[model samples]
Target: MNTRDAKEILLLYRGTTDDSDPQFCAALDYAKSDPELGQWLREQTKCYDTIRTKLRGIEPPLGLSEKIVRSRPIPFPRIWSRVLQLAAAIVISASVTVLLMKWSERRNHSVAGAQEILVTGEVLDMTCYIAYNLSGPDHAECARVCIRNGLPVGIKAQDGKVYLLSGEPGHSVNAELADYAAKTVTIKGRQSVRDGFAQLQVEEIRKL
Candidate 1:
């Protein structure tokens, strides 16, 4: 199987110890032969483990799980596949809901994230922006330095909205930033919250 196909099938592996899954075996063997792919495979496993850990960390509201559990699972070709699909669907749904929630806050109140909206905002270093309200050319150099030093980057919309920027899906934040710091740019993304912080999972960015 090619790398793409192998990656999809391996999603079902779910840390299982069963060696009988031919698809998982094929993906492993392919990854083993390729240095870069092997590294990626390892990294993907680490990311999944981290996500599972965080999910466990969240203290659900009382009886939330019971309510969720009371909902019967629909028959799917595979339970794991259904779980993954449901997770993906939930993310999209949750993102939209969060965006709308933000919109409900105020007229042109941008202190919230937006989903599928084209917004014009000033790029800034997240830490500096929150602590000092710094942005634009005056802070551009400092922002770049801070970002390179591993500080988070974000954008501030005209309506006083702040959004922590992240890459879409599998992209790395650092790699995606690539020096758009402290500039006014337009972005299209899914506006979502992670750990209660606003995030723009950027799909597109255009300098304005």
Candidate 2:
């Protein structure tokens, strides 16, 4: 399977226990052999772990299930059965909404706390880089084309950290950076990280 296919399959992978499953096994094997895919897989797994930890920390309201059950008759009547189902659905929906709100708040808090950073790295188009591991001087022209076409831009730093680039509202840094594709450059920005993904709100960039 190709990296894209393997990535889709790996998304469903939970842990090493799934190693015995043939489909997951094949995808895992492919990722192991492909450095880019392997790095992506590791980052994905780390994000999953973080989400799981956050979920575990969320506690349900005391006796919520009991309260719901007690509100209905022990032997639910036929007419009330459907009503109970609807109530249960609403309760679940409300719980999920609250959880999502909390998650959003956490993400926003991270962004609010983002610090300014200056990094030197190669300018690259995120699309081809992530999909096919394309980068460097040989891929310069193609990277330029992709960036000009509106694909997301990123930088692969000397330490191997990759940060997705963003610009001020109503502006795109793509036009200015397109010509520098696959070339080393220094960038200054506010770095926001969430779920193992990093993004840079670009303030300054200079080709090195």
Off by over 4 Å in 1: 1-114
lDDT of 1 by residue, 1-208 (tens): 7876665454444455525677578788887887866665665454335434544565769986457556965354456764785476435433443443343232223424455677688877664455444567756666665555334667789898888776644344654563878777898877776556677777788887
Where model 2 places Cα greater than 4 Å from the true spot, the runs are 1-112
TM-score of each: 0.43, 0.47
CA-RMSD of model 1: 13.4
Best by TM-score: 2
Query: Model 2, 1-208: lDDT tens per residue?
Result: 8987786677556566567998798899899899988876775565335434444566779987678678974576656865675455435533433443243334333344579999899997775566446689866776776566445788999999998777775577888898999999999988987666587878899767
Error of 2 at 203 (Å): 0.3
Q: Go through the candidates in order and give the C-alpha RMSD of each one to the true structure.
A: 13.4, 16.1
By summed lDDT, which 10 consecutive residues of candidate 2 come out lowest? 96-105
Model 1, poorest ten-residue lDDT window?
Answer: 100-109
Best by lDDT: 2
